[model samples]
Target: MTAVSDRRPAAADPAVAGQAAEEDLRSLFGQSTAVYASLAGPSHVVHTANPAFLATIGEERARTGVPIAEMMPELADQGFLALLDQVYRTGEPYTGRDVRIVLSPGPHAREAFFDFTYEPRRDAGGDVTGIRVIGVETTQVKHAQRLMTEHRALLEQIARQAPLTEVLDGMARCIENLAPQEVLVSVLLADPDGRHLRHGAAPSLPDFYNQAIDGIATGEGVGSCGTAAHRRQPVIVTDIATDPFWADFRHLAEQAGLAACWSTPILAVDGGLLGTFAMYHRTPRIPQETDLALARVFAGTAALAIECHHSEQARQAAEARARAAHDELARAVRAERELRAEAEQRAAAAAELAARMRAAAAAQAAKPHPERCQLGGSPGCTAPAEVKIADSWGDSAWGCLAHAEEAIISVRSVFIASEELGGLAAYLDR
Candidate 1:
């Protein structure tokens, strides 16, 4: 009342001024799109609700003087009533930014968020009177933030050269977990020739379905993924049973419990086909804007991962070839060295043998005798030694026609004497 009374116009009573102030405050808050509600008493009974508040909590239940807990029983179990009690008891405002809440049940259940404040209202005596609820929904913003964080993690995995299956499988699982609704993810890699798609990863898809579609060719009317790869764009088949493109696979898709598929082609930077990313749904449903956005993001990531994997493979192959060539060259050098060494050894042996033979011939030639048959060993000859001879022991031997030849041939190193000049003619005459 101190500040309020000072600001009041002349002739306006305190009660009238206070009423006018309350009306002004109501007018200011009424036009706001933000959800606002006022509750009275410790039980937190709904006393007033703006259009935004009524819209947020279905209009039929927005009656005045109804307890908040009785009107929305779902909130009581979700800790909302406890938050109100804490604010009422402590007289302290409780603010929750991006608080998650699930509304309704069954297929219509929606996940939402609110940036809300529970402020304690005061009376004329400064006692806690009631609670005021003011909030702005931020579910979309929260979801966007989550999408960015998940998408960045996927890129980091790809940049670090994670295995294709691990990356793709992890990506599929992430999308399935982050998606607002249930979805199944599949990534099929294009063959090098771009004619066929091989199953790269499909953690949520049935094994039989995965095996049946492995190595599927890229062509028109070949189902959503195949057509998207062929066209190099996105293809959406809202209902597999009725879509002409899924005619061939309708029965198989039904068996796998998939009613719809939306696929986007993953293209390299040069516009070449890398692979296809697909999202499957249980009931026939069209893709939302968020769904398409998610597909585009992961599709780009898939392209990067596949291209990097291909580059790594090519590098490993080249390295293997280079190593094999190096090994072959080393082996050839070793073999050449061994051959040269063997030839050198053979040449040395031959030279030593030749030297021994030449020395023997020289010693035999240094002392000459009259011409006679030289046959000595087993092939016996009765020719005479045409000169006298002696052994190293100084034993002299002589013969006519045959005995002298036998002694020289049988004795080791025995030969004709250099000074026996008349011996040859005497032996020949005998």
Candidate 2:
């Protein structure tokens, strides 16, 4: 009879045997988690694959009796098929870690990463017969790492108070880059009253498209962004071509090659609107879970940047107002000082005028007790001198009431003498 079996291993220590058993279990169960497939011949024909392989490459595309390159043409341009060719020709195992691969390769293409190994299979004759592919999908892990890195960078930018425009532009580019499918990002800042929106950032969109939508009103049926702002909620327009909200801008959307737009209103903690964040798609499509998650995350980031900018502006305005008030107060103080000085000068001049008038009256009293008019013009007055007047220079004159009153009014420093009032009082007594 033929030998049924002849396989044996050297005995090991107890600890070594236990470790070996654990390794064997790991190898069996861990490989099941991976995608496995076997290709036959130099052409790398797909002979068989597990469910994981079928799921990864698409159930419809997975088939036997076809070259792997023919089954997945997108792999040819991405250097994967070349690596396979090299492994098949050399009969050497090829292993790749975190290898990036593009699937589908078109508008609907997606990026994926795999940690995989291609081991060459050999017969009893030591001739290479086929190749075995064992791979584990690392796409989720890779994407998670990238998302964390990009998010951390954005947070750092915000913490350092970068310019709003720079932050917004970087955020837009980051979302566009991170999205699995093609998406355009737009951020529109709201007016202080939230009645209108001004363009903030739209790097991937056409200039014409951005210009056309700038200064759009925030109201119902205005557009996706406008409606979202009006309602303080998200607005998703899956098909802009048929949506009544886009009635006025259908032609514009067509020109811009946008068929769907989803907008989320960015609001402050107190419910005040800050702005709107939007995502546009070329084809009419509904948002997936991942898409909505991304929008929510970045919308909050945009809100932070916008709020910080507004706070800075408000602080600057308040500082300016304080400075202006201080200047006004200083001016008022200087004006008060000038007015007080002018009043003091007027008081001193009046005091000097009064002193000279008193001295003039005393001199006049000593000069003459005029019986008749001694204070006349060139022709002497026969009428009685009834009143006495004196000027700032102490020059005195006695004349009738009319002429004395005229002289007092005509000259700046002329005044009625105290001696004349005494004379009039004596005359009245007599």
Candidate 3:
């Protein structure tokens, strides 16, 4: 009698229906890259979850038969757990587009976006028993969009010829904000000769650290950035504390709490050194392909900025030299004009003096014998006229020794004169 029709129909059994619903949901999303999870019972224990779901919540919470809240305590504070509860009790499905959440909240937390749905699962009696979560992470899409916007802005800055330092600093900040993990971005500018690197930007690095490495030389074993620059290639130091390249800077890296550094050399189109772009991490870790790609992209940007800066400096230098040359030529022309004017004045003065001497000589021609010195001005000299001086225009004067010497030295064309004296030599002979 107890065995009579004891088995119930599969549709009537709540457990069977629940199992079928879970299978259907899994079959739809299990193989997909999209995240999928099914919670069971009023407690909303994680009954089944795909790899994407486990990865999204973190692998540490991958176990089933545990309440979602306990498995992902961080989600409770983020309001995700409450949403799950609401869907379970109200039997309503909720869909969210571009929902933002911070995973593993703390200093190491990361922001993630998702397009997701929370559909309540009903049993055979139409009673809501659990919630099924299906989600696709939009974090990369969002990050890519942001990266494009920031990259465009940087190009604009370069196009407008913003200061290199300003562009580099902004780029460092942008990369720091863009990276999913905490990263310190630094750019070092190469010297004109490419023998050393100067600090271009490091907004996230400690001031003391930045100053210490401000002008590190480019050479082998000179830390990641310097070595990268010297080799003209990328350098990846996964463990700064142990890498030979970091031997000289190990203590500094330790003090700065840096464990890893990846650097890519920025080069000009002609293969000249521009600078280095570096990403420093607090933990020792290898860089992925994506990380390398990011470095290359920004290194090119740094090159563009540095090249623009150098071109502008060269143009300014040339303009300054041209201006100086123009100024010097103008000064020379003005000086030449002034010299010609002064020469003409001297010539005119000499001509007038000659004419005055000739008039004086004509007045004195009447006297043949000596009197006082004729060249003596103001108070007359009582010395006998011992010398006769004449001008080039046949003007003659009689003077004592001192007056004759004075006249010969001061007058432009004065000379000794007499029938027996041919020049100053004849007067001296006498």
Candidate 4:
């Protein structure tokens, strides 16, 4: 079996060759924090491994003549052993990109991804000797891709104006699914006054626990979420049982099987507090970088959703007021139109009455004495005739002072025609 140092071709200048060899080794494994190993023979016995490989699988197991399968038995079921077998038998290389594997077992189990290749190695005699395993870790890339997909879906829901409760609940579920470990996610919205935090979403939490903290006030030492909102920052309670902030709620939290809590305040762009995004753990555990990053990402998303919701509500309310104003204007216009129509009708009637009175006057001028009480038509007037009145409808009558007064009141423009008697007062005096 050949070591990595001996496999290189000799250079004309030994000094240059040494430097080139060192550079080649560094280049092959640089920019990667993944395990790399070389296996020799048909049995796939471990020949050598890089520092990363030894650190991952354990330094005690980093020895030659040990079969790769014996060292990392977990890879046997993950199809890595089959890939190595295929490469060794066919003299062809096999590459697996973004392949997920669960390394170790029980409490030590971790989710990992690899961009790896298994290539056949050849001896000087042209026969296949061993297989070379080169790989780069892609766990972070895998997690990021998943995170973006879920986050984009949430944004789309918000864009379409989904119910606020539905959006918040879905976001909480998304984080729960994407977390590396079991986590209970809760989103608490701030009341309009900013003094109290209201439960927005907490699917995994117990109903009793949620009710107990529904309207928790935002103040110093109020609780993890309350304190986070009050300070407008993140609050981490690694162990709820021992933390002073949890003294009031510790019994409830313990009953709910929640041991750790990390709360981050969701803030608007103007620095106003919107709500809190919290992650609860069943066991007491410190947060990793990934956990904090997840909190920040979802916290920003929550802020966007809340702002959009508030804007939509405001716009709807404004539209309703505008509609009411328009209706009022329409009513006012109709009333004005009715009043103008009534005034025009009254003016037309007055003009028609004036023309009738002029015709009556001309008719009276054509008659000599205007016999039979000029103001009487159906019944004879008991009072003597003293005034002559006529109308354009070819009707004329004579009447006394009392009858003449009645005629003027009932008819459209009938009055005394004589100017010498000084009208009705003179007739009455006489």
Q: Give the per-residue lDDT digits (tens) of candidate 2, residues 234-259.
A: 99999999999999999999999999
**What overall lDDT, based on C-alpha atoms, would model 4 receive against the true structure?**
0.82
What TM-score does candidate 4 reach?
0.69
Top candidate, metric lDDT: 3
Q: What digit string (tens of lDDT, one per residue) describes model 3 on residues 1-430?
A: 5567855457766687767767777878878889998888878899899888888877865788899878877887788888888888889999999999998756867899999999988766789878888899999999888888998999999999989889999999999999999999999999989999999999999999999999899999899999999999999999998899999899999999999999999999999999899999999989999899888888988898999999999999999999999999999999999999999999999688656655545544554757778878888888989888776466677899999998877776676665343233222222
Prediction-by-prediction clash tally: 2, 0, 0, 6
The count of residue-pair clashes in candidate 1 stands at 2
TM-score of each: 0.71, 0.80, 0.85, 0.69
Cα lDDT for residue 215, model 3? 88
lDDT of 1 by residue, 275-367 (tens): 999999999998888789889988988888889889988999999999999999999999999999999999998687445434443443445
Q: Candidate 2: global Cα-lDDT? A: 0.84
| Candidate 1 RMSD to the real structure | 10.1
lDDT of 4 by residue, 11-117 (tens): 88755764574466556765447667778898899876777777667665566679988888888888888888888889999988998988765676678888888
Q: What pairs collide in candidate 1?
A: 384-401, 386-424
**Ranking of all candidate structures by their TM-score, best first:** 3, 2, 1, 4
Report lDDT (CA) for all predictions: 0.80, 0.84, 0.86, 0.82
Task: Indicate the worst ten consecutive residues by lDDT in candidate 2.
Answer: 421-430
Model 2 spans > 4 angstroms off: 1-34, 58-61, 341-357, 360-365, 369-386, 399-410, 421-430
State in Å the error of residue 323, model 4.
2.6
